[model samples]
Target: MQVISVNVGRPRPNPGKGADLTGIDKRPVNGAVAVVVPGPKGTGEVGLVGDRVYDVKHHGGTDQAVYAYAREDLDSWEADLGRSLGSGAFGENLTTAGVDVNRALIGERWQIGPDVVLEVSSPRIPCGTFQGWLQQQGWIKRFTRAALPGAYLRVIVPGQLRATDPIQILHRPDHEVTVELAFRALTLEPELLPQLSAAEALPEEARKRALRRSSTG
Candidate 1:
């Protein structure tokens, strides 16, 4: 697969979630961008340089560092929604072409460009902020039901990433915990949390959350 666009965001006013500042207003950048592993959530940092998120409690961490969405999926949404959705429209840092991002396995490693290696960590869970940005009623429920939540990634090897850079699969963990599966486990299907244990490479917080759910159930 290839990177179609590299997007970055700046903090801006967003009244949708009752916040004065939000980073959901991302736009595609023309050149290469540096990708690095940031500190944990609430640290006010992100994987891509110049990107930031307002909801510190729920966003911007190593595990959820780089968000990626497929160009194919965006096209599908455009057809369904009857509007054009550009790259970074969903606040993803990477807009990928010809990649089944939602089907990517948890812990799967992709060698982006020549040096950057990104590991799949979790699924992008829709929230009130996202819904408000889209201004669509029932959007959160619709996105969840669609089961096409994009993949969240962690920087395994930091490097510069540019639009049209090649992406190679460097590793695929032997597990059934795909991004779709993880999304379901974290959202619609609590019973599936136990199944996530197979993906031993999941981020500690995600693994702990799944294990806790499994244990509780």
Candidate 2:
């Protein structure tokens, strides 16, 4: 697998984004970008250099330092939506090819290029920013039903990343809680939240969320 494009966000006004000043507009970059783990949930820091997120409370953190989406999945969406989706259409940092990103295990590790190592943390959850950016009616519900949310990753090893960089699976946790399964558990199938505990290596915040939901249920 390889990176088709490395994207970073650009600030743009959006009245629909509520109090947030910027809309979700990410564009592909031409050269290498640095990837590093951010500090905390409200830090608004991300792995990719020059990439920014307007909503610090919801978007950036160590748990979501990077977002990756498969070109194949985007192609599927393009066919279904009857429109073309360029790289970074979903606000993903990396647009990848030949990778089953959604099916990746929660704790799987990917070595990008030669230096960067990113661990799968969670799945991207649909938000108002995303729906407004796409201008799609009922998009949140539609996306949730589709259950194709891309993967969010935490930077385990910092390095530079660029388009066409090779992606290697350095490690895979022995867990059945794939990215898709996590997405489904969080959004569609709350019943499965308890099962996510088997993915011991999953990000702590995500694991706690699942266990909390399961216990409350």
Candidate 3:
């Protein structure tokens, strides 16, 4: 695993579109190389500590050649150019390798630094801000629906992360409720709720959401 790039950020809106249009640079988050967290840093399996940046698909994206987001669709589907299913930019803080991050279930963990271990929380969803980042309309929606279930991670441990460090898949949860499966089942199939309920680590709040949404959609 190689360090794709080191991304730092500040409190800002969506950075760019498809790693091309978002003009915001990801070098300084509120003017610090890193930041401190109360417990852990972020929500997804990979956490953005200092500046709120995203570690998108690993191998690459639809745009350009390869990408910084470590987890790529190569792990799940067939993509020739090595693209992230998410139309993301290159400002991800830590790029990872050797893992289909979309398949990372909740309760999954990764040892980021001596002091930082991250946990998978939820699949990264598309939002309106992504449109602004890419300078196009419906970009976020298309990516979320088409290519992948981009993910976010919460830092379980807090330490320093320099660029070029190796990203290791330290742990994988035993549950089979992958983010991709849940995304499809939650959005397309409600009969899978029983399977979801089988996840021993499924959070109560998220389980409620799943059950409620399944009933309606």
Candidate 4:
């Protein structure tokens, strides 16, 4: 288990959307990482949800960082068949070498480095920013349709992390709701709410957000 990448971006209101957001513009577009300053939203100025800061209502995590690349995917890389870094399919803050992230299931736990411990929260649901980045319409919808997708995590013990840090799986929830399952559950399958509820490790807001999406099934 190793971190394939370390990423964080400033949540400046994307001034340009639809198409302009796709440029390979270095993130921290706001010029600084959102600090842990006191604010009206939560206990601290730094929203400790994901690894990034947003309006709370919009982006509710202090750690936008994610870990991806399950063991099955890693073998491909070792065999020189894996995708390259920065590829759209590898949308994770940290990519593990031999971890099957999608199977890890939301609410699972992992220990990275000497101190960082995180609980899987939900899958990184696609947003308009993602669509703009790839300049593809309905890109997010397509990702959800694929399922077995990227995971979102909540930092339990925040520690300094960097690319190449080893990852250790501490636990996997006794449920089948994986990142991809949650993704499709959030963006596609509304009937899976019972299983999603059983996953039990998902952040409250993410579950609520998922329940609000369209459901034709």
Candidate 5:
């Protein structure tokens, strides 16, 4: 697999969800972009050098430092929406080709280019800001139902990466908690939540939710 484009957010006014600004307007950038581990959540810090999230409470942090989506998935969405969807249109930092991002297991490690290493941590959860950005009615429901929420990654080895960088699957955790499975469990199917406990690399918030569901069940 390879990276189709490296995107960075361009801050824009967001009247939706009461956030003054949103970084959902990501555009492809040329040249190498630094990737680093961000601090905790609620700081708006992301892995990319110039990109950050405005919805601090729900986005960013080390667990969600980078978001990646497959070009194939975007193409599917384009066909469904009858519009052109380019790289970063979904607020993802990396648009990849030949990669089944949703099928990637939590804690899977990928080596991008010759340096950067990122680990799958969670699945991107659609929010009000995303729905507003797309201007599609019931977009949140549509995206959730699709269960192609993409993958959120944490920087394992900080370095530089750019468009067309080859991606190598360095490691795959011995678990079945893929990004799609996590999204389904977190959103529509609470019964699957108990299975997420097998993925120890899941973010603290998601892990706790899974734990709660397991205890209750």
Candidate 6:
């Protein structure tokens, strides 16, 4: 697989959520962009050099330093929405080709280009900012129901990457918890939560949630 585009956000006023600014308006950028591990969550720091999230509480951290979505998935959404969706349209930093992002297992490692290595950590959850950005009513529900939330990645080896960089799956954890399964368990099907524990690479918050569900059930 390969990266179709590398996107970085430009800050914009967000009327959709309580956050004053949103970085959801990402645009494809030319040349190489530095990739590094972010400081922590709640600081708006992301993997990309110039991109960050405004919703600190819910987004951005080592576990969610980079978000990636498949070009194939965007094409599918285009057919459903009757509009053209370009790279970064979904606030993803990397728009990839020939990668089944949703099917990627948590802890899967990807080597991008000749340098940077990223590990799948979690799935992107739709929010009000995303809904407002798209101007689509009930978008949160629609996206959740679709279970194609994409994949959030953590920087494993910091380096530089750009559009057209090749992506190689370096490793896949021996687990059944894929991005799609994680999204479904977290959103609609609580019954699947118990199965998420198999993915030890899942973010601590999500792992705790799964633990709670399993204990309660």
Q: RMSD in angstroms, all models?
A: 1.3, 1.5, 8.2, 6.4, 0.8, 0.7
> Backbone clash tally for model 6?
0
lDDT of 5 by residue, 1-217 (tens): 9999999999999846858899999999999999998999999999999999998988899999999999999999999999999999999999999999999999999999999999999999888889899999899999999999999999999999999999999999988999999999999998999999999999888899999989998
Error of 3 at 203 (Å): 5.7
- Compute the lDDT of residue 61 as modeled in candidate 5: 94
How many pairs of residues collide in model 5? Answer: 0
TM-score winner between candidates 3 and 4: 4
Model 3: lDDT of residue 157: 60
* lDDT, residue 12, candidate 5: 97
Q: TM-score winner between 1 and 6, please give it.
A: 6
Backbone clashes per model, in order? 0, 0, 30, 24, 0, 0
- Cα lDDT computed for each candidate against the true fold: 0.89, 0.88, 0.48, 0.53, 0.95, 0.95
Per-model TM-score on C-alpha atoms: 0.96, 0.95, 0.62, 0.67, 0.98, 0.98
lDDT of 1 by residue, 104-140 (tens): 9999999999899999988999988789888889999
Expressed as tens digits, the lDDT of each residue in 31-105 for candidate 2 is 889987788877778878788677888878888899999999999999999999999999899999999999999
lDDT accuracy of residue 104 in candidate 3:
69
- Write down the TM-score for model 2: 0.95
Q: Report the candidate with higher lDDT, 2 versus 5.
A: 5
Worst window of 10 by summed lDDT in candidate 3: 58-67
Q: Write the per-residue lDDT of candidate 6 for residues 29-125, one digit (tens) a residue.
A: 9999999999899999999999999999989989999999999999999999999999999999999999999999999999999999999999998
lDDT of 6 at 64: 94
